[model samples]
Target: MMAAQVPGFYMKNESRRVKIPFIDSNSLVIIPVSVNGSEPINFLFDTGVKSNIFFSKTIADELGMQYTRKLNLVGADGQTVLSASVSPNNHFDLGEIEGIYQAALVLDEDFLELEKVIGIPIYGVVGHEFFKSNPVKIDYDNAEVTIYRSSALKWKPFGFRSMPMELIGNKPYVNTTIRQIEGPEIPAKLLIDTGANHGLLLNRETTDEIVLPPLTLETDLGRSLGGDLFGLVGRVRRVEMQGLKFRGVITSYPDQTEFSDVIIETGRQGSIGAELLNRIKIIFDYPRERVLLKKGAKFSEQFDYDMSGLMIRVLSAENKRFYVSQVRENSPASLQGVQLYDEIVAINKVPAYFWELADITNLFRSEEGRVITLEILRGTGTEEEAPEKLRISFVLKKQL
Candidate 1:
């Protein structure tokens, strides 16, 4: 109701509003896409979203879109939370329809490094507003969406496709049946985050339970929005979804963007990432409180990095100093008493700023007790003086 009062954006401004069967808050679907030639992989429909966004690197490279400039982003309270990788504006053609669009590359140790993205998977994000101009449905039953192109027709969920799902606690769980990707027999029950980039995410428990497949290929830095860190990069034989499956190389990590600690204890199942959601035509029946899961026609596995939160930026400036940038609320860094804007100069007598991603990872690689110290720069003017160097110890136990 409140959203209706304000002027809409792009498609919303000229949207055809028609209420279709909607799930809780996901009454509408938004899918902002860049038509890349005639590839079936171009158009996308997405629901769960706070905003519409896209990283400029892969999409720009694919279509030769010029991305210029850099932008900084602040949290809701206006603190510089992170920096954005910017590119020259570009235009998007959605099927026969076309529209000009702008994009921001998320650069922080968490989102990705523009030039170093792995596999160059998903191009950008589409919000529910994208559907405002067109009424679309995800039929979990048929694993496809029936589109109405015209809002004049009463919108209805056409295909109803529901994959067999298990719930962990209060979250939906999906079974992972990939070979050699063995973890505990207790399958993972994920939240079915339609908003997540990677179609699936492995929890620490699953990560610990499964023996890591040997690295067929290793990237210098495993990526995430969390900044360039070490992750085992390679492929797995196959991961299945309700008997439907695809074979592809996948990157495995120990962190989840949201619900980092959400666990599937006794009776809980694993989670579902966008990788699975985007593949099928499905509806999140929030109104009826069900996710009408379905399969998509275009089911080819494209290379995509399962990451979040940081941008990997190479320092070209000499005498460059790295600040804390910003810390995640109650994160390990914050819990250790690290402050924002503090300069991390070195670690336990080891220089940190110029160190490669591998260096930091090496220090934390030990499967036993590991502790490192930091020499930080804090304050300005009178605060310009260095704070007493503090040493913090952290355990690198198998992340569960």
Candidate 2:
């Protein structure tokens, strides 16, 4: 059930637990969030979140919030969303916790929902932005999460470090660092985005906010996780998690702004994206209010990438349905004229069947420069005089 909206303070009920959904972190209870100088307000514990977001506009207009100008948002999907600023005070009377917080006003928005009732019109989404350095622990069985300040334990299996990020209207925002493909690093306090598929998404207009070096790479457009935003793709100079930094050659993009549900206006300027993937073992701790990225066992061959511009899916001939989705651009599949929506009828003279997408791509990405034959049922020809089981041979390429 969704969390029931509670206005006044209530003692923690030992008998029942509430469930709420958050990105970076998935689901947790709605415990009271106490500010330095205000009443203890309710907050949903979310691990899916990479930062914090408090909608100042909703608070001011609906809840009578005080002060500020336009706000900006840095989202994890690698987009910069700017907004008019506002004071976080009117959003909630967090008493003593009212510090100089950056925020944006918001209307009804969503990130993810693991709730059905016990609903809440979120004033803000709080996440890892609260703590950066170490890993925070969440005891869902016990209904609590712990963050260690100063002294940290040494027994961590994955030494992942997460950085605190700020969000506006639910998306993360930050200054930015867009590294040129060659030479020097362009300083950008970009977003810590997980909601994006590729690494870095940059725009000359927004990325130029921070002084950067000359860019040498060509970029293009990319799709957002929610398909809500189009982002510029290019490489980042460096992506840092806590003090552990990874540098050099990465891909990013440019142009077009992003509008996300999870990335709210809470003062941050940029969102973090794919630059942090596979490179580190991610302990995306939402309950701990931090995203811990650990250096995990790296396979030397794992990073060896070759694209065969074919997004393929496995299907059961009998079921007449697909079970895979692997699309690579500029690949043999593209050269051989394999359309995206093609229905596969056979594989190597046999009626092919697959249970998962992984199974298809495993066969597709494999055998580079090797000839593979496929049989397809391309739509219809009259009634159903046996849908043609095509046999076409093609070679796979290493570039996409």
Candidate 3:
């Protein structure tokens, strides 16, 4: 059952839990949230951010939020500059808990690029401060998230592996060991980030465990709040955690030259995100300095990647639309005439508007030799000129 909307405050009923189902998009936890009683929209449950961040100023305007001040923030180590406005106050609901955040920051960027990469609508991101006074439990297998009051909760692990975490400026860090095939395990520190959807990102600046496997693919990993975090994707022979071992784990390494050092200075070797975490059910107990993990159904599942060499994002101005923002060179998409800025108006003869970005993206990840039919609209439609619409078909091929 969806969480029932409640008013005011209620005393803690430790036994009572509000369960909110979540979508695992690119290892990022996307949850439905209603801000200021508005219609439910997708929000990234992120612990990496310092405060609650609304992706667009239009969101603040639509909510009738009054601005407190304006500030300039550097993101991704000066890769992209953010112009942000502070909202005086805001109320949002995550599961059954209602949170009131003060001085919420809304960015000028629409973050449609981010949605394109993740293939979902991410209206905003709620960070540490949003739940600083509360506790959250995340069950990856069941896709349920529970939020509890900090004072009314008592946590006891039942057969779950518990790891002691160190909180530095609101982020959790833990130590783990990673190894290449037949190599000795190398100890490394990783930040537990629920916001990231990718499995493992080893900072070449910090650790030397990021060795590209025999087979690797050059792809645009994902965009950061600062800018593009591009890198190569491959697999490591094994990764050891607490007393468990994950073999042949897919890993990614961001080109230090293209990324910023802000992540490295987090004082960890690298970061662990949803992809790996999804293998286990996790509880992020911030107030208690502990993270509980239990193996989940996905623990043994192999990690598959986007077979089509295309990066798509959405446009929400008039209606929701998906477009090809980037295409890999010499890949199946580029070989089949897919181009930058090509509007994906339809798929399999169905109107593109009929499908969500997630659906369109999933089609791109089909097994090799799978054929996909897409309707493409090229050029802009004008009063005298109409955009060229072309029907294109391509077979999905694994690049790696």
TM-score winner between 2 and 3, please give it: 3
Q: What is the Cα-based lDDT of residue 183 in candidate 2?
A: 50
What is the per-residue lDDT of model 3 for residues 1-400, given as tens digits with 9 covering 90 to 100?
A: 1122322222234445556688876556788877777888888888777777888787779977778789887766355568889886777765455655445788887643566667666788877764454556788777777765556446565777877888887788888888865344678888888888777877777755555667777877777676666778887777777876777776887777533466666768778888888888777777778777788887887766778888888765237687887898888878989889899888888987788776666678768999888799898789789989888888899775
Which candidate, 1 or 2, has the higher TM-score? 2
lDDT for model 1, please: 0.43
For model 1, residues 1-400, the per-residue Cα lDDT tens digits are 3533332223333444322232211111223344434253222234533334455445445666555666666432222256656643445445334344434353433354322222113445554444333334554323334444343334334555445443333233455565544433334444554544444445444345555555432333333333433234444556665566656635354433333332433333334554455566654433233344445654664534312111222322234344454443433445667676666577667775555432343344433344545676566626457456555433333221
Q: After superposition, how far is residue 205 of candidate 1 from its true place, in Å?
A: 4.9
Ten residues in a row with the worst lDDT in model 1? Answer: 20-29
Q: Which residue pairs clash in candidate 3?
A: 26-197, 27-197, 28-197, 116-313
Evaluate candidate 2 by giving its C-alpha RMSD to the native, one decimal: 11.6
Q: What digit string (tens of lDDT, one per residue) describes model 2 on residues 349-377?
A: 65555323334445665666767677766
User: What TM-score does prediction 1 earn?
Assistant: 0.39
Q: Which residue runs of candidate 1 sit more than 4 Å off their true CA positions?
A: 1-3, 6-160, 163-184, 191-199, 205-207, 214-216, 220-226, 234-238, 246-251, 254-279, 298-400
Give me the displacement of residue 312 in model 1, in angstroms: 14
Residue 110 C-alpha lDDT in model 1: 35
Q: Which ten residues in a row have the lowest lDDT in candidate 2?
A: 1-10
